[model samples]
Target chain A: MPHTTPQTPGLFSLSLSKTVEFALNQALRLDEAQGAAFKDFEDKTFAVTFTDLGLTLYLFFTSYGVNVQNALQGEADARIETDLPSLLGLRETGRLSRVTLHGDVPLAEALIDALTSIEIDWEEHLSHYTGDLIAFKVGHATRSAMAATQAAKRQAGETLKEYLQFELEVLPTASQLQRFGDSVQRTQAAVDAIETRVQALLDRL
Target chain B: MNQSKKTIDFGFSEVPLEEKVKRVKGVFDSVAGKYDVMNDVMSLGIHRLWKRHTIELSGVRPGQTVLDLAGGTGDLTKAFAKRVGKSGRVVLADINESMVRVGRDRLINEGIAGNVEYTITNAEALAFPDNTFDLATIAFGLRNVTNKDKALAELYRVLKPGGQLMVLEFSKVTQPLLAKAYDFYSFNILPKMGKLIADDEASYQYLAESIRMHPDQDTLKQMMLDAGFDKADYLNMNEGIVALHRGWKY
Candidate 1:
């Protein structure tokens, strides 16, 4: 038998809320380092209500992970109502200090911590399709190449700036170029002095 | 439908066994558009909770085969499709083509049809080989069957050994006070609401009468046992206004 005891109803009674929550869980898998900070979210109730979209889902965090339902089975420890844009904004900025909270502030903070802490195991995930060794090698090589590219880009930018400032004389001061503005007059003066000296020397000879 | 000596309960009235299916078809055809809305109102939106509890108790496994008899609107079918997932098979079968079409269309619209198949089948004679299913369910649909005993036997025939059968239906209320209040609401207000919502008063009246005609919880459990199911038991919900009977084949 499949795991009938998935902490929720069977698929025969699968609601949209449960499926959405399942998709979210599958999308986010936490490793130990990032997940340890969110240990406080364990065994807590977090509710997100989208009043405009006509949806309210209660998320129960258990020993394993979270389960979702449309109706609240008990008094929620934290409740927040926001639209899609506000939720997306929260994800990007990560500063939800001003939102109205119905219950424990720490619970909401723990949710943010847990959500932001999710670090997907790309190697393990890719191994499902590709073999483990290949996936690890690919992931490792990709990460190394990215770091090398970033360092090379920084080095190239700094070297270009130095070349422009010292050799090309494009930075810090334009005043040094003022002497070159009358180069033609200076050249003509030197030529005339040289011609006069040459005529005198010839006459003396 | 029996040719010899046959009359079955069509709501409060007795009709030829052959005619009951046609009359039931009429009722469903009349209310197919408003079926989901009426279910919410008639059950006071608690039907979802009841269904959830029923599915929780079913102990269905992945890669298992399920037969959803008279799976009107595919409520349980949709839910089971998720649990069984891609590896499992869930056949949403109904005797009435109108209900089957509605169920198929609704399930497709909801994107729950990946592992599901539709069949137009009568419970009395399921169009499948013996030992075809790992689990079978008849939710709210069994009450409309003209021959409950024959249908029960057919369900027993189709299920594989170690399989389970769950029947969810309106049954005798355990508490007398609540039962009396429920009776008044079922007989009186339910039909009027049906009239207002579905614009079909007689169909809702038949629905109410059909609940009364269906066997009580204990009787249903005994009938399951008689049909070769073992360890038959029932769990009543909402003061027995509804009951879920679970049994298994050895």
Candidate 2:
């Protein structure tokens, strides 16, 4: 009932909460605006209940940054209840349709907007430890790898479509699908005409 | 060495009641600088989780007062301050001035000053007014108290009606095999860690003995009930290596 999962197994939740807290605070510090996005949300608490994990993490907004913990002595100002898949969908699509938000709805929406608006200059931060040139090289390599992966994925999809449509004849080709659509439309028209004739005969009777 | 002198247990050794307090103070004073480090090294950083669990169970709310008695180094105090925010107040009180100073300085450095206060007060006789705190905690500091019953009474007295007190301390290990291994580790390896990290072997030795001398889980629950708590219960962590005793004042 309580978010005690973190305390159940060797305090794994505590470690996770600490890691998330540290990362969120670090992100806030690294933001170019210096956490100005969260200024208005100070002292407000947001809770995210991961239904799949059966854990609720409370994110307390402070003047400096956010403090994330699994337990809250009191209720959160905004609580979002969703499973992992829906959460991932929300992240990918930037949509709140999949998750349920309770309490101050406007506050939750604003918090989500603020979170999505956070833009950290990762390359700039990385350059602090690894100088400008090296950081540039690493960032360049990562971008190149991502581009290559996307290209490969597109090529694979095309190849699978060709094999399925041509080689194996397992899926209908474009022309065949068009013909099937026409036939279905024609059949629907014929059925409508037959129904109209039957209704007329019944009216005469 | 008068035969009529009141005596108390200082670790494994018996000493005069007044002397016990002084010696306990000396131990904390010696280890004050390296207390946090020694705790991490000895407990493998699991002490933080134990304290976190205690805080979770406290159900502390904003605008409610909390007293972290024997709050050496203020780990719980820092967490409570964040939750209580600007509206609530937290008092970090400890008997040993050295420990209190370390906790105060650490909390201030972490920018936790506005809603938090620090004090040097004995657990047996807290300085706060009656029914003052909504939540009170004594983590790992109760074992060192000269009179635990008196200290429990003081904690109960300070708590508001419907308030809660959480005591996080080392207790008897539940598993027999683990208990034997823990005994071996506490006696043989723990002191070595203290010696290596804190450079104080004697104080660490006393730490281990005091834990063994502290009351077991059920015993502590009964003591809280005797202290006038309406309800008292305990939860064992790490196979009973540490226990959190909670008492509610109605």
Candidate 3:
């Protein structure tokens, strides 16, 4: 049996479960397992005890959002089975069957959940902090603009054209400038959006 | 009996097929010594500005590879080597052996030796592996290619992911009055300048005609997109006498 010790929290430290210990002991009897490192021996048989864990981890790490079927197809097409099976104590059909049959899904599911939760938390924190700053800046500009507009209306003295010209000529307050900038940005975004759609259409032709 | 397909337009003039290459070669070979001189003379030193603009648009950085296609006399290639630094490489390639040899010797004489390679390659049939180059440029060379689309596709194939292709070439004039004046200057005055300066009248005449026959801006942009380039766009310069077309492989 392979003896191990815990190293860190949440990260894999030197610790072997009872199933892992049993597999390691059984693997030592095989000629292929002779002179092999503990990590190497465990990798060879973990799949038998952990069935498809190596492939699953490989697919997840390599193609982040790829579907399981596609990942499997890619692995099979690339002839990864022979090397992978031998490397992980999946030497015999019986050992492979045992791992697949006994390995639990809850651990893999828990790992995925933890990773997703971390991503969401980081994004949420950035948005909240940035959004607050933007809103405060916008609010201050709006108040200043409104005051200037009212002052201009008072000074313009009744002729509609003069009042209109005054309104047009009034230096845009920071809020007004921000709104103008936003509109220009939105217009540019729309142009880019349309260009992409048009390009896609052209590509089909 | 079908008339012997005797003459084809080298630009607009009817020239025999055997004569076109000789004519084209004469244009570069004649201008070989004064090519840089005449560029400054003809464009009133705005050629330097245009070449600088091309360099700026190239987005060349340290540790990047660049291929200056149809690079005559090594002007652009010299500037490119400095930007790419000692770690990066620049190849000054031209189809014409005379132009290539002249450019190579000029660069060697200038002591711009390290990190530069010279090759005589046709734009349509570049002897390079696919997706190897970071950037490829055909400065004033696209119009002369026998098959523009094939050359463009070849350029597309050589570019690595996120690589750029820039073409600085003559384009259609936008203003009618400017077009008329340009035509008169190109047809009448340029040949006279060529005869007096370079002593080659027919070669400069071919240059003027080729500019007119070349496709305009919008057509080139569409062709670039068809060649699998994303965000293909052009910037017209000098009332559209010249345009810089840019595209990227992603």
Candidate 4:
């Protein structure tokens, strides 16, 4: 917490919240999905309690813009409580279960849904910090490689399973493990018999 | 506005302290209509981020009182008004009538009336009572004040115990090469752009000079301490192009 209020013993948390708010607003401005998430919920108020710090962050929507503040007193359309670690982790996992909602759970979920809609173009953003060419190349390569690897994984798994089950018949159809083993042994015996006959014929010639 | 017997620095030139406020006001009045526009051109729209950062750092809460001193065009005031909601009180005060008028009108146009109050006030002698606000901010406007020491004292007087005041203003560019390039841009290009956009070059030139005339980062932190702040600190942004100084009146 970086931007905590004057009363709070921790100033850090307030700063962190402020940064988060700025980023959220910036994303909302550029992203239609994120902006639309709050559009339907205008004039709604929600409270988020950082249970560990004993601070309740209240978010209220106004005609102008969304407001994020500490909810000292009063009721809201929704109130959510979660620890700091869980709150941060929710971004990565995209899990609403990490937070507990009191008033309007569905609205809270919708808010999260809006946040999930924000698409981060890390390569484009990083280009400004790093270099344009490097960022583009890296981003492109990463997406291509990831797609190829995922496709290969799915196709390879399916093809190998099908080949073993249908073509080779090495895979058991049911719980008949002994029957499958016998079938494989029978095939092996037939192959051995053919090889032995060929060797005996070759010897006679 | 308070004036001392000693002379004050007015853009590389020392002048009578009494004359600084009127001159500063003249500059702001001349460019009141174009101030926001010039800010966008001069900083390349980075001023918004700087201001947003200041507001974020101020840590203003709902139902808390905030004094947006020198809130020209109500950039900080609009955000504060929204954050404070109906319960909170935000006073968008500026000494310059032109800037204050612009701020009031802008806030009104934005439909932000309930929580915000507009006032024309000199920072050296704030009109409000003691312990009036939980947070006070002077962004890019403190440099224009005639008596900064007196203004800081007045801010301290108005703030509640544990209340914080944030001063976001242009400061020294520490890097020499960057400073030289910045100087070239300010002296050569900024005024020309101002003349083209606002039809006012002197005010833009004054703005550039004022940035240089304002105290450096460490000096401002010391001034905040001397003004009876229990804790004072500053974080430089854009490589010391602007600094956000924060002081707690505990």
| Candidate 4 segments exceeding 4 Å error | A1-65, A68-205, B1-6
Off by over 4 Å in 3: A1-205, B1-8, B14-22
- Better structure of 2 and 4 per lDDT: 2
Candidate 2 on B12-102: residue-level lDDT in tens?
9999888988999999999999999999989999898888777766655556799999999999999889877787899999989999999
Provide i-RMS per model in Å: 10.5, 4.0, 23.2, 6.7
In model 3 chain A, where is the ten-residue run with the lowest total lDDT? A1-10
Compose the digit string of candidate 1's lDDT tens values, residues B1-250: 4475598898899988888999999999999888999999988898988887766566554466899998988899987776665667999999888888989999898877668999998999999999999889999999999888899999998998777788999999999999899999989999999999999999999999999999999899999999888768888888798998877887
Candidate 1 reaches a DockQ of 0.02
Ranked by lDDT from best down, the candidates are: 2, 4, 1, 3
lDDT per residue (tens digit) for residues A1-205 in model 4:
1342334322333444454555566677788554776777665667677765556665666545666654232366777787655654555666544678788889877876765667533233323434533454476578878999999999999899889888999886555777878889999999999999999999999
| Among all candidates shown, the one with the greatest lDDT | 2
TM-score (all chains, Cα) for each model = 0.59, 0.75, 0.54, 0.64
In model 1, which runs have C-alpha deviations exceeding 4 angstroms?
Answer: A1-205, B1-5
DockQ of each: 0.02, 0.15, 0.01, 0.06
lDDT of 4 at B26: 83
* Per-residue lDDT over B1-250 for candidate 3, one digit per residue giving the tens place of the 0 to 100 score: 3334566567987776557656677678778877877777677887766666676446455456888999988888987776566667898989888888888889888877788999988788898899878888888989877668888999999988778888999999999999999999999998888888778777788788999989999999999999888768888888899998988888
User: Who is ahead in lDDT, 3 or 4?
Assistant: 4
True contacts kept of 1: 0.02
- The better-scoring model by DockQ among 3 and 4 is 4
Name model 2 segments beyond 4 Å from true.
A1-10, A89-91, A119-205, B1-4
Error of 4 at B162 (Å): 1.2
Residue A5 lDDT in candidate 3: 12
The docking quality of candidate 3, as DockQ, is: 0.01
- What lDDT tens digits, residue by residue, belong to model 4 across residues B45-76? 98987886676556555567999999889999
